[model samples]
Target chain A: MKARVHITLKNGVLDPQGRAIANALHSLGFDKVGDVRQGKFIEIDLKESDKAKAKSEVDQMCAKLLANTVIENYSVDLVE
Target chain B: MKSAIVVFPGSNREKDAEAALTEITGTPPVMVWHRDTELPKVDLVLVPGGFSYGDYLRCGAIAAHSPILREVKARADQGMAVLGICNGFQIITEAGLLPGVLQQNAGLKFVCRNVNLRVETSQSLFTSRYEKGQVLSIPVAHHEGNYYADEKTLDELESRDQVAFRYCAPDGSLDPSHNPNGSQRAIAGVFNRTKNVLGLMPHPENAIRELLGSTDGRGLFKAMAEALAA
Candidate 1:
């Protein structure tokens, strides 16, 4: 099984990197961009054959290491 | 006072912290490696600054989960004095020993320079040598030092007098212009609920000597030695 996790800054958290990206896009004449936010994507390979078990384990990994719950949120997708 | 300095693989400030503590306490501090599971008996634990684990994943994230941090957390919970400087501050916060997360700087650039800090309280072991409202010049070097927390937590920290220091002008006034990293309410440092643990973004260890351009950082180490000796 393979697990994919997406970690994003929580709503209302200040993201300077996202803001800078937005500004650079604006300078490049992409005027439609609005309020960009940045995040992290992590992929993991798990030997667990059970989908339920892999999901639970990946969830724990996100909670403990992948995401800082105070300022970021994480979601996991499992594929077998 | 007997002290220990936690050394992470990428930590660059342990030597400075060791020198500061040794000068003030008249004894060298134990340098505990990150993988150590047990800490020798010591009155204080100092977490120095640097790009621990190369700031991979997040600042201080990997180092926070290192083996020795478990021991540090255990000792801190038992009322041992813990001081986290710069990256150390991020580590303790990431380990849940302190509230709030240190995000990237608002300017999105690494800031490395001297800044003025106003002592917010003189009641804690970390700031006992300085008077409330006194200004001290300290150097801060970090890319992620902007502190953030929920409003309720911030209010609680304020109500309990947990704010130990705040960025300020040389004359001791709070303003966004003086805040180098855009920390909430200009907080440069804070104390844990029990006041035994302190985490701050400035490198007081680097400012311990007059030749270093300022002797302001000596007060923090002196305060720790005095309070722990009592």
Candidate 2:
């Protein structure tokens, strides 16, 4: 089984790196971009065969280490 | 007074912290490695600044899970004093010993310079030597020193008088211009609810000697040493 984790800064938290990316996109003439927020995408391979168990384990990882709950939020998806 | 300095693999400021603490207390501090699960009995645990674990996946996020921190956390809960500077501040916050998180500077640039900080409260063991509202010149060197916290947590921190220091103008005004990293309410340092754990972005160890252009940071070490002796 495999899992993917998406970590993103909370809505109200300041995202300076995302702002820089947005500015770069604007400078490149991609004016269609209104507001942009950047986030982290992580994929992990698990030896566990149970999809349910894999998701629960990845969820724990997100809460414990993958995401800093104070400033960022994380979501987990298990791929069968 | 006895002290131990925690040294992560990528930490480079342990020597500076050891030098500062030794100069102030007349005793050398033990350098504890990240892999060790036990810490020698000491009055204080100093987490010095540096790019711990190369600041991967967020600053201090990797090093926060190091084995030694478990001991540090236990001792902190037992009322032992723990002072975290620069990257150390990020680690303690990630370890849940302190509230809030440090984000990148608003300008997305690595800011390095001398900034003024107002001693917010002298009630904690970390800032007892400085008078409330006294401004001290300290140097902040980092890219992610901008502090962030939710409104409710911010209000709680303020009302409980847990804020240790705030970035301010030389004359002590907290205008936006004086905030170098865009920290919430210009907070430069914070104390845990118990007041024994302190996390601050500025490099107080770098400002301990007069030859370093300012001795303003010495007051913090003095306050800790005195508190331990008493």
Candidate 3:
């Protein structure tokens, strides 16, 4: 089993790295790109065979350690 | 005054903090490891700066859950004076001992330099040695020193005088250019609601001696020592 998680800065939080990417895109003539927010994608290989159980464990991981709810939100996907 | 400095695995500033406290308090601080669930009874707790847990997951996030902080937090709730500096500041916030989150620097650059900070209040145990509105020259070294909090929390911080320091120009003006990390409202330091916990980005311990460029940071340690003695 495997789990994938995506972590992103919550809305209304200033994304300086995203803004820097947007500026760089504009500089390179990608004028249509108005915004670019950066995020993290983490893949975890799980030993648990139960897909439902693995998803629940991953969710706990996201809430406890993988994502900081104060500033970042996370979504988890389970794959067999 | 007996003081304890919590030392996480990656905490490099523990010695500096220990040295500063010993100089002022005339007694060495007990080095408490992160794995210890028990701490020696002390008048003050100092959380020094460093890349704890190699700054994995997020800065200070992993360190906040360390067993030692559990005890530290409990004591702080009972009104123990806790001082968190730089990375230490981030840990307390992640531990929920302090409000707000320190995000990456606005410019996405590591900043290390001397900054002028305006003292906002002298009523707290941390800044009582300095007069209100005094400009302090302190060195700050961090990559993620930008402070952020919700609007309501920010309002409360201002209304209740929880803001301990703000970046300022030499003439005591609030200038955006003087804000090295783009912290909200130029905040350099803040105190908890009970005014027992303080978290700041600047390294006051690094500036406690005149030969080290400035002794402006001595007042903060002196204030803590004097308060503990009293």
Candidate 4:
């Protein structure tokens, strides 16, 4: 089993790095880019075969370590 | 005052903190490694600045979960004084001992220089030796020192007098231009709701002696030592 997690800064939190990336894209002539936001993607391999248990474990990981609830949001996906 | 400095693998300022505390208290602080599960009894515990855990995942994020932090957090809950500087501030906040988070600098560059900080209040143990509104020149060196929090939390901190220091001009004016890393309301340091725990971005330990270009930071250590001794 495997779990995939996506962590992103919450809306309204200033994302300077994302803004800088957007500016770089604009400078490179990618005029279509607007309001870019950056985040982290993490994949974890798990020994648990139960989908419900794996999801719960991964959720705990996100809440405890992967995502800081104060400024970021996280979503988890599990694959068997 | 008896003190301890938590040393993470990548922490580089533990010596500076130890030196400052020793100079002010006439006693050297114990160095506690991150892997340790117990901390020696002490009046204060300092989490010094550095690229802890190589700033992996997020600044202070990984170090926040280190074994020793569990002890630090427990002692903090029991009214022990905890001071977190720079990356230490990020760690404590990530550990949920403080509100808000430090994000990337708004200018997108690492800022390393002296910034004027106005002591917001002298009521806490950390600022008792300094007068309210006194301006001190302190050095802040971090790429992610910009402080961020929701409006409600900011209001709560303000109303509770949890703001310890604010970046200001030489004359102690809260001018936006003087803010080095775009911290909210120009806040440079903050106290936990109980005021026993303090986390600030500026490195007071680095500015303790006159030869270091400013003794303004000595007031903070003196204040803590006096309060703890009493």
Cα lDDT, model 2, residue A15? 82
Worst 10 residues of 4 chain A by lDDT: A11-20
Where model 1 places Cα greater than 4 Å from the true spot, the runs are none
For model 4, residues B1-230, the per-residue Cα lDDT tens digits are: 89999999899999999989999988899999999999999999999999999999999999999999999999999999999999999999999999999999889889999999999999999999999999999999999999999999999999999999999999999898999988989988899999999999999998987887898999999999899994
Candidate 4 CAPRI classification by DockQ: high
What tens-digit string does per-residue lDDT give for candidate 2 at B57-106? 98999999999998999999999999999999999999999999999999
Residue A42 accuracy (lDDT) in model 3 = 97
The chain B TM-scores of all candidates, as shown, are 0.98, 0.98, 0.99, 0.99
Tens digit per residue, CA lDDT, model 3, B1-230: 78899999899999999989989878899999999999899989999999999999889999999999999999999999999999999999898998899999999999999999999999999999999999999999999999999889899999999999999999899999999998999999999999999999999999988888988999999999889983
Tell me the number of clashing residue pairs for each predicted model. 0, 0, 0, 0
Please state the error at residue B147 of candidate 3 in Å.
0.1
Among the candidates, what TM-score does chain A have in each?
0.97, 0.94, 0.96, 0.97
DockQ-based ranking: 1, 4, 2, 3
DockQ of each: 0.97, 0.87, 0.72, 0.91
* TM-scores of the candidates in the order shown: 0.99, 0.98, 0.95, 0.98
Q: Write the per-residue lDDT of candidate 2 for residues A20-44, one digit (tens) a residue.
A: 8889999999999877899999999
For this target, which candidate reaches the highest DockQ against the unseen true structure?
1
Question: What local lDDT does model 2 show for residue A39?
Answer: 92
User: Which residue pairs in candidate 3 collide?
Assistant: none
TM-score-based ranking, best first? 1, 2, 4, 3
